[model samples]
Target: MQIPTAAASGRSRLLTSGVALAALSLLLTLHAVPSAADDDTPARGTASMGSGVLAHEGVHGQPAATDRTTQTEGVDVSSHQGEVAWSTLWNSGVKWAYVKATEGTYYRNPYHAQQYNGAYDVGMIRGAYHFATPDTAGGAAQADYFVDRGGAWSKDGRTLPGVLDIEYNPYGDTCYGMTHSQMVGWIRDFLDRYKARTGRNAVIYTSTNWWQQCTGDYSGFASTTPLWIARYASTVGPLPAGWTFHTMWQYTSTGPVVGDHDKFNGALDRVKALAEG
Candidate 1:
């Protein structure tokens, strides 16, 4: 039998070591890669206003309003509430309503017609709100989706301008994995598109903490967009930069009638004025 040379044995060992090392590197890489399920992107059409807020910020006691003579009462609803009891809510003193219309570019609220028309039928000034999913699609695309779905505004005195519900991300990153400037840009895109399509500046629904964290408290939209601040407290605390006063306030998640409750900054006539605009 021929004896294998030392050099040949050394080369064989080196080759084997190289192969083993390569396999180990591949295995490590495979382990480091995240799966599709790991991405935590929210399912289409599932997000709603205050869904993330309620998850991040727990519920608080409904502060007693010494006098609600000037402020108008309202409610916001989503698919979670199903077919809402509009008459019950109206009887309970809700003068206005905001119904979730679309989420991202995929989910349209199935009960939008019932909730939106139901409120209007009950003599409540009603509006549609789009739950923004900034990560799923471009702002303009999502805005188009919203208007196409049910967020369109009309000259009717009962229909309020569509609302852009841009708040905490319930599925993943709080800012939907966007930087502050990017978030602001996305909002501007949506708002601009909505305005072009409907001839009305859309309302912005967001909490102070979320607006500050996600948009760097950018006040550019303040001059044009109506601010719908969400804060579950006795008082509205501090608002996002730029706005001296909130146009509307979402003050409670567990309202007496149904869904989350809100307050228009002014009286019923003012609510009608906003609807007319």
Candidate 2:
């Protein structure tokens, strides 16, 4: 299948106004992973916008405006294991999943493996892999680790948009001891490599602090990537400044799923739209 045209590959979701593109929508296969509102969140992307239109408004050779990601039902896994049943999770009800594939320099994720593959085997179409990035290693390394070990993706090396887990991990040493700039540099380098190998831009998964502390500057690639923001609170609100919009929002963190004992996830309506439209 030819990749849809999104101008310049991946762009910052902030530019999209964080709303679903009502005009054009499509279905994808994604997995459930862990996500949080912090700095170390990783980000990466890769996809040829067949028409470069986000909401049919920006399809003019320009990337589509995710101002709306069609309202998807998603879940993050790395946080809990043995709770969600792999075989029944998707059937119980889940549209897309952001499964954690890698973290820091090592760590392939013990739970993500089964959960990610399970989502696909069960039939969840909207799928993607997430990386837990640290401000120390940068994005490039994270990208490499993910692409190399994330999972059995298109050998053509492509996914709707690969994820960068950009969240601060105080307990982990993956960040090494690099300065803030050094960390962001690594992320940029990773995004670059990911695009070169996969032929698309990478998405950045970050929170308010991570965006300010590690993801600052580097807007040069904003138009080439998307931002998956994790801002959890009492209720869903607008995205942070600079970011036009978020590709996926982790609104709620706890829920019920047949696969997992007690699961946490987001709404599924949008994801269904992404599949239907």
Best by TM-score: 1
Residues 1-277, model 2: lDDT tens digits? 8674576344545346334552223222233343564435333221111101121112112112232334545565653453346555556556566666666566666665566667666666534554554543556666677788763245321123566655554344423355756766776787787887676666666555544555454455456666665544433345445566555655434335521111122344444433332
Candidate-wise lDDT, in order: 0.90, 0.50
| 1-277: candidate 1 lDDT, tens digit per residue | 9899999999999999999999999999988888777877766678888877777767753843753446888999999999999999999999999999999987889999999999999899999999998999999999999999999999989999999999888778899999999999999999999999999999999998898899999989889999998888777779999999889988889898789999898889999899898
Q: Which number leads on lDDT? A: 1
Quote each prediction's TM-score: 0.84, 0.59
Worst 10 residues of 2 by lDDT: 46-55
Model 1's alpha-carbon lDDT is: 0.90
